[model samples]
Target chain A: MNLNNIYELRWKVLPPLAGVAMIGMAALALVTAPTEVIEGDVQRLLYVHLPSALASYFAFSVTAVCSILFLLKRDFKWDSAAQGAAVVGLIFTLLTLITGSLWGKPIWGVYWQWDPRITTTLILFLIFSAYLIARKSSSLDSDKSARFCSIYAIIGFLDIPLIHMSVRWWRTLHPQPIIAKLNPALPDEMLLVTLFSVLAVILVAAWFITLGVETELLSQRLLKLRAIAKINISEKS
Target chain B: MSEIGFLFAGFAVFWAGMFTYLVILQVKIRNLQSQIDLLENIIENHDEV
Candidate 1:
């Protein structure tokens, strides 16, 4: 197939396919996945919680890379994409924090804590949230705003590794990295379901990023067109 | 609340958040699409002159 047909297929088919896969995987995770010996059914929250966190990290990583590329090329496409990724990443990060808190209430007897992992992640969320706010500030010109946010995005990414390593680096109430460990503590079935959940979430997140980028690009084009139309009308007058 | 209750709450919040974001994005996309259509029409009529 030609490139146009491929783009059409991606635009038309991939989202619904990803949606179906996400629903199917979520159902499988809820109904069939085995419970952990200790945590019981409460452990099931990990399926979505951990995956959401991973997806947020994936989203922000895209934002960071796109921001760098935008700065290098000074292209609006990259700027729009970086903004889109930041928005999606923020959503995912909020979800992750919420789910983590939900999981904590039952297991830790509290909804919030100052643990290293959660604190670092909360900081990561705040940093990117500020980056998004910077994008919408009317004080700076578009180019300046983009450049400023790009630099902020690069700086914000430094927290990601710190968040990941918080449990290892300091004494924390949060658990160590299970999947990233040399030996994962989970059983085979639990690990399988976790992997499926992460895969489904990444697919859904990718679709959201695509939608966000397209919306931003279209909005930018419309803005430019309206400006041109206004200029044309003034000239005619 | 029972452990099962917490599980239900977690999943509920997850799907609710996802759907809410999706709805907001859809609304923004719809608005942009209409604006784009209107701008294109204006430009086309201008070109016709």
Candidate 2:
């Protein structure tokens, strides 16, 4: 098939694939994974919590890379991609905060604390949220806006490393990285489910980014077409 | 609330957030698509003229 055909095929295929993977992951988390003795069923939240955090990291990483590419190439395509990834990253960050809060209420006995990890994550969310708003509200032209946002995104990405190392760098109520060690803290089945959850969340995040990029490109196209139509009308008159 | 309640709430919050974002993106995409279609028609007609 040609490139357009392949593109159309992906647009049609990805949504259902993401949906199925998510359902399968949920089943594994809820049914197949063993319950923790101490935390019991509440431990199941880790499946979604950890995966969403990782997915947000993935999305923001995409944004940061695309932002750099946009600066190097001065290509609007990279800017569009960076914008798409940022929006997806923001949504996932919001989900991480909310779910983490829910998970915290039970384990920590408080919905929120000034813990290092949580504080840094909240900062990440706020930075991206401001990035999106600034993209819309800026008085700059399109190219300048993209350049500004790209710089902002790269700077904002510095927070991810901080959030990742927060648990290690300082004493906090938050748990350290479970899967990052040579020997993971989770049992075999739980680890398997968590891995599957990460895969499913990443698939969904990819789908969202694709849709977001399409929307951004289409909007740009529409603006160009409108400008052309204005010229045509002015010439006719 | 109980442990089960928190578990359910966490999952519910996740699904709700994902679904809401998906809906918003879909709506925005649909609107842009329609606008593009309208502009394309205008440009094509102008070209024909």
lDDT tens digits, residue span A1-237, model 2: 788787678678889999999999989998999988777888899899988988988988998999999999998888888878888988888888888888788777779866666777788888888888888776323899989999999988976676657654665455644322222378888889989999999999999988888877777777777788889889989
What lDDT score is found at residue A162 in candidate 2? 67
Return the TM-score for each candidate structure: 0.89, 0.89
Pick out the ten consecutive residues of candidate 1 chain B with the lowest summed lDDT: B40-49
DockQ of 1: 0.78
Per-prediction fnat: 0.73, 0.88
Evaluated at residue A163, the lDDT of candidate 2 is 66
Q: What lDDT is reached at residue A111 by model 2?
A: 92
Please give, as one word, the docking class of candidate 2: high
Displacement of residue A78 (Cα, Å) in model 2 is 0.9
- Which regions of candidate 2 fall more than 4 Å away from where they truly are? A1-9, A139-141, A162-184
Query: Chain B TM-score for each model?
Result: 0.86, 0.92
